[model samples]
Target: MDRAPFHPGPPAEVTATPAGDRWTLRFVRDLRHPPERVWAALTDPARLREWAPFLADRDLSTPGDAVLTLVDGDAVVAQPATVRRAEPPRLLEYTWDEDLLRWELTRTADGTRLTLWHTVADRGLLPMVAAGWHLCVDVAERLLAGDPIGPIRGAEAIGFGWTELRDTYARRLGDA
Candidate 1:
């Protein structure tokens, strides 16, 4: 049976390495679309909401500084995310809590090369975090190609991402 084209396997040449508790996911896809088109998909709030599940409501057209709100069921996670690195059709970075989230886009011979890096909470929530980020990247790629892929349900929906939140605190030395 043929699979839906909305989701594509990570580009054959992709790499992920452990960085302390954080992980770095770097891959390059030859998206058929132009960088400007891809950039807007990454920066526009309406487009973002369409692709990313956590974002219920937010605006990005007036891109400068804003308080971003992300929802996971009844709980709401708000972070003061800023466009730290903006190069237009190139790089975008912001603060997702303490960890830094960045997206690096390059206009390649084939298409746009995107590098998404997130220094989010790991150890306990690592697996779910990885899955969520992985899904986000998939959605971005699909959206650009005008595929019918849907927004991803965050780690919370599966009941595993939050299960390990307490483990992070237990690791503190002499904290018992």
Candidate 2:
């Protein structure tokens, strides 16, 4: 039997909240997989490479300093990160460069609810950030379902409707 093609859904459910001088983008996604499975994808280096926007040098399951290399085709930029909190398949908070990322995983009746609070210095980048993460989680969900479509991020995401999602998110989120 032929497999069905994968097409990412619409923009994720995201909202922007003010955090000191910076802004925090709250992105929520519900997956059909459990928390343990999703947590591995978010913490494991090899699994992160398959879906995340960056490649982790070490497992993010522990609280410590780690390096995350952002790759955009031939361009690779290594950024310093610190895992401030790690609570198994529940909460994981870390810093990526100057930005702070907090992940909360809650078990749901159907599967798991994943919420990402990313603190960024710029408010204008919220929509773009949401769009990028929208694709990342979508791909991650696919990977968990045993139907990986590879990672969609960086410049390459433009070819996979990233621009459209960004625009849509911008309109949905509006300017505050």
Candidate 3:
């Protein structure tokens, strides 16, 4: 018998809330892993490269200034970032370029519940962002489970059903 390939079904649960001039998209996902383990994947630079959309120059486990390089195909843009808060395996807040990302990990009976609050100035970008995170989270879970399908990001993400996910999110999230 052969195993079925991993295929992310749809976008995760996300809510867009108005925040003055910006919009905050809250994405919640339940991973079958402990908070401590999830925290390592979220903050470790080496681990992030395996599942994230960006590559961190250093570990994001501390509160301080850091650099995050976003890659799209051969285009790599290094963005200056600041880690505003880091609370071990619980909470983390940081900035990626002009966008602010806050992650909260709560321990659940099954595993860890990860909630991401991302604030972006462009409301039109919500669906796209949501789609990106959906793929990232799926990859992250696989990595945590020791299956490791590698990272799906940037232009390469389109090959992994990015368009469909984006469209689904756009419909679900509405005109934003």
Candidate 4:
């Protein structure tokens, strides 16, 4: 399949809300695939490596502690994370470093509605994180559409249209 050219464009609709001592960054995307398919991409390491920023030591469909290996340039940093919630194709929540990451999948008329809530304590990193996630989500959508475009990592991920996305999100978040 011929892949669509990657474009930074406008950032996805993201909302940052305060959650106690942290802020939750929420991203919603309507995928043209079923929850099962999307869930596989979200939980399976093989599928995740195709798009996600991190790789899991084990299948994330189970509730337990799993090692998360984040892609940083040529290096992979491993971290221990406990799965807070795992319910097949519907929900998955786990620890992302010191923060909590939650993914919710809902069946929609056209496809699946995927929502990601990432708890962030560093307010300064919001734009950067948001941009990185926007790119990751785009890559996942492309992969599910049968036009996988490989992985973007570390400096490349941040350099790959991140500044534009960050600027866009900053404006949207009114943090500029």
> Over the full model, what C-alpha lDDT does candidate 3 score relative to the true structure?
0.92
lDDT of 1 by residue, 88-144 (tens): 878877765576667777888877877776565554444444455555656667777
For candidate 4, write residues 1-176 as lDDT tens digits.
Answer: 33346765345778888889788888787888999999999999899998888888888998899998899778989888899899989999999779799999999998898899988887667777788888888888888988888777678865568778888888777682
What lDDT does the true structure give each of the candidates?
Answer: 0.58, 0.91, 0.92, 0.84
Q: Could you tell me which residue pairs clash in candidate 4?
A: none
Task: Give per-residue lDDT, candidate 1, residue 6.
Answer: 36
TM-score versus the correct structure, for each prediction: 0.67, 0.96, 0.96, 0.92
Cα lDDT for residue 136, model 4?
88
Candidate 4 — which residues are off by over 4 angstroms?
1-4
Worst 10 contiguous positions by lDDT, candidate 3: 1-10
Give the Å error, residue 35, model 4.
0.8
Clashing pairs in 1: none
Lowest lDDT 10-residue stretch of candidate 4 = 1-10
C-alpha lDDT (0 to 100) for residue 29 of candidate 3: 93
Stretches of model 3 off by over 4 angstroms after superposition: 1-4
Q: Candidate 2 residues 1-176, lDDT tens each?
A: 11246566866788999999999999999999999999999999999998999999999999999999998888899999999999999999999999999999999998999999999999999999998999899899888998887887699888877888888888877852
Clashes of 4: 0
Q: How close is candidate 3 to the true structure, as a TM-score?
A: 0.96
